[model samples]
Target: MSTKIKANTDAFIKARVVKGYSQRELARHSGLSHAYVSLLERAIKSVGPSTAKKLSDLLDKELEELFRIEMQPRP
Candidate 1:
């Protein structure tokens, strides 16, 4: 099952700023929806692993620097 990833907002923003990618551009390049990117940035939604990976790759940022990946309690 896919799990939620905790993205460090400040780090994420910094990475994006350094890469000079707007949310829409990041989403498009990452193959994610713009709204999803927005939600992640807003801390309204946790990023999925694949999405995180895509963003990491596209932004060329280290995954750990962007996200706090931890095991979660199963529902």
Candidate 2:
């Protein structure tokens, strides 16, 4: 996977975990499929702006914040 993709996936997973939500819960809350959430977290799929918006809403964060977080270096 590309580094940016990996970074985004990592950020998504980390944010979800920090929110104390399971993948299934996040899927339901974000109107995304559980499998898709898994794929996103695994860096097997790229998230479009719409999906990112849903996730940002579910996380109660700004969309730009989500994008910024996704682009940050992991660890």
Candidate 3:
């Protein structure tokens, strides 16, 4: 089963910004859909390991560094 991952929105955004990748650009680099990237950025969706790995590799970060343990409670 694929479990949802808890991510820090600020960190995520910062990484993207530091890399100079727009959502669409990150989507291309990470092999994820642009809409999905937007959803992730908005915290509307959670990421699984596969997706996280792709993004991590693209960002050149460790897998664990891409996310946090405490997730935002659903609204």
Candidate 4:
């Protein structure tokens, strides 16, 4: 939809695949809902910092490594 929701979708999918996890499995591990994980994979929802941290901890990835969106520059 809106520009294909580009925030490391590919990497997230890859990580999930490498870990042999289904969307439901990842959601369970991350304390998120299965529908929410599906939305993220389909690029229908953006991952916020808290969610990212949860995924990072569950996936054993650094928060920065999970998202590639450029951060706003400090003023």
Best by TM-score: 1
**Candidate 3 to truth, TM:** 0.77
Cα error, candidate 4, residue 48 (Å): 2.2
lDDT by residue (1-75, candidate 2, tens digit) is 223422255667778888989999998888889998888777677677677777887877666655533355557
TM-score of each: 0.82, 0.67, 0.77, 0.73
lDDT of all the models against the reference? 0.83, 0.71, 0.78, 0.74
**Of 2 and 4, which scores higher on TM-score?**
4
The 10-residue segment with the lowest total lDDT in model 1? 1-10
Model 1 bad stretches (over 4 Å): 1-3, 70-75
Off by over 4 Å in 3: 69-75
For residues 1-75, write the lDDT of model 4, one tens digit per residue. 121122477878888888889999998888889999988877677777677777877777776666655445454
- lDDT value, residue 33 of candidate 3: 92
In Å, residue 39's CA in model 4 sits off its true spot by: 1.0
lDDT of 2 at 29: 84
- Of the two candidates 2 and 3, the one with more favorable lDDT, higher being better, is 3
Q: For residues 1-75, what per-residue lDDT tens digits would candidate 1 score against the true structure? A: 345687889999889989999999888888778998888887778877787888888879888889986567776
Clashes of each: 0, 0, 0, 0
* Cα error of candidate 3 at position 69, Å: 4.2
**Cα displacement (Å) at residue 10, model 1:** 0.4
